[model samples]
Target: MPSIRCCSSFALAAALAAPGLAAACSTCGCSLNSDWSSQGYATSLGWHLSLREDYFNQSQLRSGADSVSRSSFAYPADEEVQRKTINRNTLLGADYSFSRYWGLSLQLPYMDRHHQTIAEGDTGVSTSDARGIGDLRVLARYQGFSDDAGIGLQFGLKLPTGRFKQDFVSGPQAGELLDRGLQLGTGTTDALLGVYKFGYLTDSIGYFGQAMAQIALDAREHFRPGNSLNLNLGLRYLDAGRFTPQIQLNLHGEQRESGAQADRPNSGAVLAYLSPGIGVRITRRLDAFAFVQLPVYQHVNGLQLEPRRLWSLGLQYRL
Candidate 1:
């Protein structure tokens, strides 16, 4: 039987922060599980490495789960517009165990993104593309509960390593600075806090729950990303030998951005996704996993482009 583990982090933190800040659309964040911490095979003092890739294409504009096909302009009196976006992320993560009760983790990501918009008033298409490294995250974790009923606490920081003020090299919006949300990074330092718990049921099934919070501590370029909260509830069936099937419910909510460059009207949202995944134990020291997230419900604040679906694939190896 496969071992049940509790591991999750902000693999998509940069993606979710981009909507309205940089692009005319919103992108889904891919929260990946960190299995090395809980699996019995990784109880010894050592280090673990992981590689993850996430993909999503968001093109449709919506308001509260309802599509917004066309909107009449109040000022122009005869204009309508449409927007779309695509984003991809590749992440490298590392975790080290200092003792049974303590550990540390870091994540670095690279991103490629495209944005496009068409308006009735303008015949030309407005498009932009950006590719580079995203932000960086470092976290410290403490496992303070019993072996059976485990509880973990995490605290971390997000560094502004990704480019924030990218300009359109060529396009209808050429030489113009992209939206702060559309940049590779927020150019802000953020504080991350999280708590998680896991346990088994009937020796064959297991369950876990986690909650994470992100708050921007400082801003750059007259812009600041919004504060956000994330919640995840998951069930793992461990009786399937080397193959483990899992299901997760993920919920995310964010407050609107604040500052001079903020896009208040098109910011903020509450989104819930149903994620189905499977894990394969390739060896005692390596594992592979994949997951797909489908939006079950969404209540966006304004007319913003939202993701139709999100997918991720990853590998973890003990080092």
Candidate 2:
């Protein structure tokens, strides 16, 4: 039998804060179970490292669960017109288990994002690209609830280690500071808490469930991201020997942005996705996985850009 650890991706913060310059859904992330997201969790107690890369493009305009045209947000008539947003995110994680009861994990994020938008009066498209480290998270886990450590709790802190003062370098918005939601970091410390449980329904069927919350501690320069929450459920076919086939349902919700610089009319959202993935063990110490996410339901507070699909690939090695 394989051990299904309760590990998840982190980005759980607030949405954009600006005069409608940034993107929406700060809660949008890879959302992978990712103990490596693969099968290399190493049931033993030791150090492990994992890396995963994800890509998504938000070119579709949506409002209140309905698709809208870009012309609906034209200049003068509206304060903003969004063009497109693209993201390629990479995550590095390290985990160490002290015993069956306790463990520690650290995660770091790097982002390559491009945004294009037009202000209310500006006719030209203003573009900006941000590439750098986003944030760092440190967490502790306790899985001593059962003899097999199938139930666990996770608590952590999101550090403000990334740059939030980047500026657009092209078009009419050149030299203007990038919106809070598009920057490399949120610029605010956040608290994270979550719980998870994993077990087997039968000898070949395994199931897991998790819920997490991320709340901002304070605002920075009159801008703050909203609080976010996530819920996940998954099942894996364990009969495949070296290969594990999996399916998951993920739910994400975020509050509206707050602060004078923030506009609530175009931010927060509630999104649900269906994710299916497969994992393969290449060696005893190495594993790989791939997954794709498609939105089953999406409702936003206001005008926002959302991806039609998201995909990711990952690798993990036990050291």
User: What's every prediction's RMSD, in angstroms?
Assistant: 4.0, 4.4
Once model 2 is optimally superposed onto the true structure by TM-score, how far is the C-alpha of residue 46 displaced, in angstroms?
A: 1.1
Candidate 2: what lDDT? Answer: 0.71
Strongest candidate by lDDT = 2
- Please report, in order, the local distance difference test score of every candidate based on alpha carbons: 0.69, 0.71
Candidate 2 Cα outliers beyond 4 Å, as residue runs: 1-22, 25-28, 36-43
lDDT of 2 by residue, 24-129 (tens): 5334456555752112233358887878898989888788898888755545545666778888999888888787667778888888988888866798888899
| Clashing pairs for predicted structure model 1, backbone only | 7-33, 7-34, 21-180, 21-181, 22-179, 22-181, 22-182
